[model samples]
Target: MHEQESTRLGDEIVRLVRMGARFRGMFKTGDLGAEFSALMLLPPLRAMGPMRVTDLAEFKQADPSTVSRQAAQLVKAGLARREADPADGRASRLAVTEAGVQACERVREARAAMLERALADWPAERITAFTDLFEEFNHAVEALLRTDPTTPPREPA
Candidate 1:
């Protein structure tokens, strides 16, 4: 891509990202502060199944103390619980509770509602095309990570 085109792409992505962040903050009305931590589950929990608090901190780019406390709050709220990792006696792992699963499902519903509202008139093929392009873009990003593992990951769009 030409320099100007690359700049425009980045600018557009940044605008979308800022919009997404604001929307999340504004529309998370159903969630108590406790339920807000539910958003933190998808990445770490999805990839590693049950992960240690230290691992969750690294995966979520959060401080260990904060993750530890939040994990405790999740436990108290019955959203997630800690387990003894039998393979590693010293490490504790976290898994989402049934209530946490329900919360995740609620998040999915909200996401679907947002998409439906945004694309009320969008053609089905356009949605498919968007999915394809996004997957290709995701592949390119994974390639970049493989090429430069030390490069910090960009903020999501």
Candidate 2:
């Protein structure tokens, strides 16, 4: 890409990220009583099954203490539970509860509804093409971060 085109794309990406954060804040304050940070832990636990806090921290690229605190909130909210780790009887792992699964479903529905409303006027073909390209872009970014040793680690959005 030309320097000008690259700069424009980068600016657009940043704007998109800011808009997403604003949307998340609105959702967090509207119907999802849980803190966004704590809610974020659910997807990983759901996807990976039970995992130790340390493992989750590594997977999220966050500090273990932050993950532990989030896990505590989730536990207190009855969204997640602690279970004995079969691999290490002395340690415990966190697992998402049925309620947590339901919460995840609700979040997914809300996000979809928001997107549908926002794009209601867009042509179906355009929406489909955008979705495909967006997924590809995200995958490219993840691959770059994974393979590039010189890339600096940054906090998750």
Candidate 3:
């Protein structure tokens, strides 16, 4: 990429990261009363039905031990349940409970509503195009995270 293009992308990425941190803090401290770290597990569990800690860890690119602790917290909060994997006598899968699903839905709706308000001035076509591009960008990021040497060394900020 050209230097100017790369710099603009880096700046945009940093801004997005900062905005995400702000939103996370807002949700964690508000009426929801759930920590962002723990709430993060709900979406994957909701989507995947049930998953082992190792499976979640891989999917999240997180450490197994960390995911284990998060899973324990989720279970303790009654948001998730651990059940023996019938196919594997010794292993277990963590599944989101009804409460977990509701919580996830509430959070998702809140996020969507907020974004809708933020983008209310934009035309429908622009919003659709942005969504499509953002999804593609996220998949590119995931691929980069999974592989070796996806990009050149970063220039100092």
Candidate 3 backbone collisions, by pair: none
Residue 10 shift from truth in candidate 1, angstroms: 0.2
Misplaced by over 4 Å in model 3 are: 28-33, 149-157
Best by lDDT: 2
List model 2 lDDT by residue over 1-157, tens digit each.
8999999999998998789777875552344445777788889899889999989987887778888888898888888999999999999999999988888777777778878888999999999999999999988988898899997865642
Order by lDDT, highest first: 2, 3, 1
Identify the leading candidate in terms of TM-score.
2
**What overall lDDT goes with each candidate model?**
0.73, 0.84, 0.80
> Candidate 1 clashing pairs?
none
Error in Å for residue 18 of model 1: 0.8
lDDT of 3 by residue, 29-129 (tens): 24433456777889989998899988988777777787888888888878899999988979999999898888888788777877887899999999999
Better of 1 and 2 by lDDT: 2
Clashing pairs in 2: none
- Show where candidate 2 strays beyond 4 Å: 28-33, 154-157
Q: What is the TM-score ranking, best to worst? A: 2, 3, 1
